[model samples]
Target chain A: MNLDLRIPMGLLFTLVGLILTLYGAGTNGSPIYASSLGINANLYWGLVLLVFGGSMYILGRRGQRRMEREPQKPADTDSGAARRGH
Target chain B: MIHTELTYVDWIIMLLYFVFVLGIGFALKRFMKTSKDFFQAGRALPAWICGLAFISANLGAQEVIGMGASGAKYGLETAHFYGIGAIPAMIFVGIFMMPFYYGSKARSVPEFLRLRFDEKTRALNACSFAVMTVFSSGISMYAMARLIQALHVFDHLFLVMGWPLGWIFTFSIVLSAIIVLLYIFLGGLTSAIYNEVLQFFLIIAGFLPLVLIGLKSVGGWQGMKTAVASIDPRMLHEWKGIMHPATNPMGIDIIGLAMGLGFVLGSGYWCTDFLVIQTAMASHNMDAARKVPLIAALPKMIFPFLVILPGLLAISIATPHTTTTVSMQGGAIIHETNIVPPEVEQGRGLVPAKVNPVTGKPMLDASGKPLLDYDMATPNMLLHFFPTGILGLGLTALLASFMSGMAGNVTAFNTVFTYDLYQSYIHKNASDKHYLAVGRWATVGGILLSICTAYAAINFNNIMDTLQLVFSFVNAPLFATFLLGMFWKRTTGDGAFIGLISGTLAAVLHHGLSLPLEAHPGIHGGWIHVLHTYPSDMAQNFYTAIWAFSANLIITILVSLMGKPKPEAELVGLVHSLTPKPDTGHATWWRRPEALAVLLVVLLVVLNIFFF
Candidate 1:
């Protein structure tokens, strides 16, 4: 399968969000950490994973669109025709 | 509360459950018209049923008993095994792996291997997986039998059969085996799936009451928390406390170990294992197949709440009142705390005498008398805490768990035998009728073998310890081969085959050699000092997996590089299947990319709060 860079990129951001949320939550008790983070750790990490998984999916769809725009190869056209015959 | 002695009604209830399972199998026989229908449920299972079956397949008797033992021993961190170890791996499988397996019109994982690689690879993968399934089935059988005996459901069988108490284990195994076999034989995957769905609902209904009643008996969640705190403050901090050497038997880093196991063994079980993949493979189309994973994820996410929380509650109720006692063996005073209370050590010859401060007599009960037994603590709690009908439900749930797990193994075994082994090697030219007959026989054979294994499993001291050992031994290496195969295109058949064999052997040797040395470091101080102490069996599993996979990957890549690469066209089918398509268009059932992205963010945030 062709690599979808969009999904991987989205996943990277999601992972970062997760790490930040974990950092925030781990320091929930300390006033300094809580004020700086502005969100509890649990919600933060949850949000991060959700976003990461989500973005990859979106990027995957977008990559699919770009690939569709490219000119079809002779081999691809032949296979498509063969499938139609079957 | 029902008496410790199970009444006639309990036996009747148990029998009814068995009959109901068998009945479902027979009832679903109409769906088994074609080989495809029998093996893949005609690729038409609904999302909810598939999801339930997926969860049910994973929830075996071993999990229930093992989780209980861990909760008693390790406090709340034990829940991580269920939550993090199982749930996330399942979610990953659903999200990522499902699309690949289900989208491809493959009958079994071995079939996929055949498509991706060659016949030799398919045969090797199928046989290895079959062996693992048989071994696991045996373990599950033994665990379920032990639970039944504990519940005293086999006293009648002992009398009727003119057998010893040991026969209770036999009876339990035979009963479970026969019931599971009857269904899988008659209905195949369709029967297994429907039964699993029913069993899943029954198990949940059965356990919910136990948790609720247990909490009520313990004076609610806060009271339970206080009880646990009074015993050990560390119990509340699930993560940090889990890291302690005393808490984890193997003494390895918890998160690292769990995630490693998750990546390797978890991927193999959820992603590549035919038993799980078959459920999704039964979907009518690619969209339905895709839906299987996401729909399944919801149940996987929720199961720990039912299975693991009750264990934590059990620990909270039992911990504070726990006591230490001396054993007569070497006049050794074992400082037992949490779960093993003084009241528990009345009988069974484990506990030794301690003089009373005032009475100058053996430490006794309220009447200044000796206690009976320590092992009855969990059982006593069940009888006292849960109400009558609810107790039946709890026991039934436990039994349902066994049925679900066993049925999955049996179905997978039958599929492998019918398609890969029997049809491929034994009777390549056999008719459909002949193959179907053989499939039924294979199911029966699987049950009998598992029963024998279960008998052996019972002799082991603790069920959970045995299960972890079994999983680590097989899954670690199996995971290595599948992971490499899935991603690395250059890996040749010879390399794949050799790597799998070598990785498996290495993992077994490491587990056998390293485990004993770790357990008795005093006897082998030199070895112990050199080899780092691993924490839980899960950690050892991770270490073994890493070593095995590393060895396998290196060998596979090296050998492949030296040999010929697979033709590009050969891999096109697999590659194209995974490639997302634009013009194909999206269905309403498909999660919106933006919404999914948000959910991913939320999941990560939740994980960080708990994990970090």
Candidate 2:
């Protein structure tokens, strides 16, 4: 169970999410969106990414914490082992 | 058609995106302790990430632009690609097919064939797939280079640096290819998947704004509808002229779409194509694997809203609808036909439109029309809408999409080359480390091969057409072989192998025989005049697939029944009836693949009805 992806994925998403959210918020009332059917897509989508990233980050953090609480058990993964053909 | 300025902020944003993607790739390089990690992401990706990458692999820059071009040429009718062509096949793959693929624990699609039938079948699929992947990947490279050239992205930079314009296309291709080769060489499939997911987000971020700005410029969806309807009423109809295959602008009818595209070509791609399925295989478990393609369905069904609509909107904006009269040799005069005047074509509309002397605007005809280049619709729309900062993001999104597609193909190519061809034949029983080394070298070799293929691919007319030709030539018949072999225990190894070869031959024969004599616009198939003449390349591609598939199914059944059937005991996880889902007990209704498939089908139906 190498579920070690969440942390890095979470960090990347959060970083991009933050930038987009701020950019969206700053451009909220800009006339640039006049051509976009008056929809602040950047704002809504940015917020959405932010929430998604935040949730992933929290879950990853909690999982890491839970794993830390357990005794330092060796990983049970067959990570480098060659796979057998079907 | 449109020109937008790029600012420092946009440049910074673009630069950041590139650095971040490359950074992720390099960082993941340390995790590649095994060949499995390089080839299959250590089989540990989540369903959601896998799902995004699965769809994003196909959603390349070529597809993005091609969809828009289709929209401009064919109108709402283009939705059939997503509606009839993709959704059903996706559901079928997720529900019925993934069980065998995931449960059998096949490392590749060819491995599945080897398990179910034998090595000969696997070899056939592996060889064709390896070749096709390289060719297709190269096409993407060529297309991206061509697009950047068309947009004049490098002209200004080259001018400032005293570089010749002729080197722009080659320079762009080589640079992008090197960057891709580096990351993929480092991280392999994991890097490709990660980059694809990032690209999925980047694509949405880039295009959503374009759509909003575009619709607003045209006064929303209603305005687009009115504008397109005013231009050509047929463009508004999903199935208007489909009843008359020969007469319609888009050759084939609904029946053609359902059987040719949906059943044969679509199933072949979604279920069996290794490039698409590699992401799904990287999932942690059976349940996640099943969810991958199913989840991809939702986005596939709706992408036309962005990809296709932009093309239609761009055409409307171009508005080359000036009515012209033409007299025939027999003295019959055609009236009010929307066509470009010969003089205007000679003066304008090749690269850029001629401008009015007084107004300095693009010159309009007596009927207030300007020359329209339908394929440039999406790019023009991007230029029309986005300002400096966002424009870079949008263009980068397109670039990201192309890169993602290229990465997917390269990864698939190397895996197939090393695992199926090289390891099995040339160096049997090689160490895992040795295979890993071969895969890395293959990545470099594949990129170089793809560059050659891309240059070769330019002899063809359109990227989309070339892709369809490949599908027709290889995958259509392959789907039939998979369909029979997976479910029927009676299917023989000899039957599968022979059937595959014959099916490919049938597709080639069909294409070389049935095409029209004249050089037709929108026709990019390898058809010669012999049997039947389709009105468009779409029809030709579909019919060729249909013919090939029919031949494959018929011959496979005939050959299979001739041999003694394999016993049920030997076909546990390979056969549908023998393979039971022991792990599915804990899965709730929503989590079940079949349930998810039904929900997706229902949504697809609703979308089709709404559009129709």
Candidate 3:
């Protein structure tokens, strides 16, 4: 629970975004775009993904910094151990 | 059978997803130190994380594929499943029910029943719920594997490796099962919830573009409406021609839809079903737990656009015939064109007819008309629009949905099995660490059992169908039992147990006596005798749910009158009237549960009106 979920999520999107962006950029104006109605969808969607991925990464890092500044209560972890059975 | 070639980039995107999920599992391993952490994430998740996981848990492959199929068959009215059916019940649960669940401090839903009722009721619920989750996860796996097989996604690789083509089904099933098992086994509920949140975003990222490209192809909303109207104008309206079962695309009137889907099935599944409620219960505080469902309602209300719009586009758009030339390994040239025709028949559209595999001919129904395979709508749209790179992303989105759903069920199953079954009855005095070990083992057992069921599904499709039908019977009347137990303190354990049994029997009896028009008496219903005929199968289903709910409600009241009630002192937090009002904390008015519920209700009304 200590791990900020957005960190992994951000990393994932960033990686996928980078892959698609590069692929889209490389494949620009190729006949492969014909299936997508002559739209360079890989490039456009890649940029959109890159933006989304970047924002999540930034927000996650910010959250991690804030969490480090204020340590969590020990009671938070103890509650789970204490309440073992109904 | 629309098959597309995938580029290596697509494989990398997919492989990266698998790596990230497993990475999350490994990262969270140290945090899962207790049974509580493994089963319930130590009840420490923030509301937003819990909120997205809440809906994502239920957004399995079947939900995506099945909703799209329903959209093609029932058209715009398919939104009723979300608009009327899911939204209200979600709000009701967040505002009214979460306090009892979160405050009572019960570890599981069945445990809550034990606190409020008795041991018998809890045992019944726990056993049935545990079994149901395993089968459902298996069904999800089966459906995904079948879809992969049908799409021939991995056939080229199999062929290149000198493997038989049939190995794709087994390969896909085992690969996905292993992936789901590893993640949940390593990190438990926290991993599942985190992965679900990621899957939610991925689903939007993948499908939003599909909808956009599709709408553009079909000329946007107005254009799609015009095209669909040419086929059947009724398909374009949510409420038009819904006075009678025969008129509407769903074959159910407003009363049936409202009572059966909205009140009965909706509340039963969304409110009481452990799969969704577990996500909310994992919240860090009571206030966040209360807000979980409300926050989920925001995305739940608008999902029709991302999931169902593709079906509309599939049925509406006329994909122009354009040849794509391909060179075979033997140096033979082949040209491929669009499989879905531009002009479509009413109620059929782009969906192809089911074929008899043995005869290699279209399968005929009782009335001699070929049955349509409407499930292809969403997949067809994916193939119709996406090129190679984006197509990989789209397929990965689908794979994400399947794995998320499987993990959700496995987590729910393991929790119930370890806590409600193993600890309660099998080994009451086991240490927390011992129970934690048992929980991990149960996760493996659950996934392995699901794999068996998946193979069972592949061999005997009818058995899976019957199992699903029986599960629905058990589920249909559950909301009534939960409603009475939570609101009325007089509800006794005996009454609940008997009420639930009779309610399931009522569902079976109703289904046995009725049959849908133009259908034979079998899995579709009328096993006992055709005492009644519904206009369509959907109408019969709704009525069956309504009957089951009514029987449970009335019978529970009557049975409770004859039995002694649980003492009121013990029922303080379990019953609604007895529990103290939950504090909304120092959050502003807009952030409070009530305020958010109200906002969601308003949005629901606007959506219904716009679609109406």
lDDT values for all models: 0.60, 0.76, 0.86
- Runs off by more than 4 Å, candidate 2: A1-86, B246-249, B318-372, B457-471, B516-529
What DockQ class does candidate 2 belong to?
A: incorrect
Best by lDDT: 3
Model 1, runs deviating above 4 Å: A1-86, B1-5, B8-12, B156-166, B241-250, B318-343, B346-381, B456-471, B512-518, B521-530, B535-537, B576-584, B589-612
Ranking by DockQ: 3, 2, 1
User: Ranking under TM-score, best-scoring first?
Assistant: 3, 2, 1
Top TM-score prediction, candidate number:
3
- Per-candidate RMSD, Å: 14.5, 8.7, 3.4
For model 1, the local distance difference test gives: 0.60
* Candidate with better lDDT, 1 vs 2: 2
In order of appearance, the predictions have TM-scores of 0.74, 0.85, 0.95
Which 10-residue window of candidate 1 chain B scores lowest in summed lDDT? B319-328
Interface RMSD (Å) of candidate 1: 19.0
lDDT of 3: 0.86
lDDT of 1 by residue, B1-612 (tens): 113334343455455667666766666676577777777776655565676677677777666655655555455665466455565566665555554565445568887777766788789888877877887888777667766776676675677678898777766777777788787888888788877766666666556555666666567878877876776765555566456556543354655556555566666567667777777777555544545655665565555556655655655553233332212224332332344434333322222234454764456566656633223334444554443223454576678888888889888998998898888888898788787788888988888878766766656545545555555555566655555665666767777777777776666656554542235543222233434555445565667777766666677777777878677666653544333431224534235322443464466447535632
TM-score of chain A of 2: 0.67
Instruction: Write one digit per residue (lDDT tens) for candidate 2, span B1-612.
Output: 223345444556667777877887778888898998899888877788899899999998878988987888778988988887888888888888887887777789998888888898899889988988888888889889988887776676788799999999899899789878988999899899888888887787778767766776677888888888876777786766778775455767777788988898888888888999999989877778888999999888879887988877775554332433222224342333455544324322222344554775666555666644455768767765664446666888888899889999999999999999999889999899999999999999999998987776666546656665665688779899988987888889888888988899899888877763353423453445456776666777788889899999889899988987678777778887676653555667777777888889789878877777
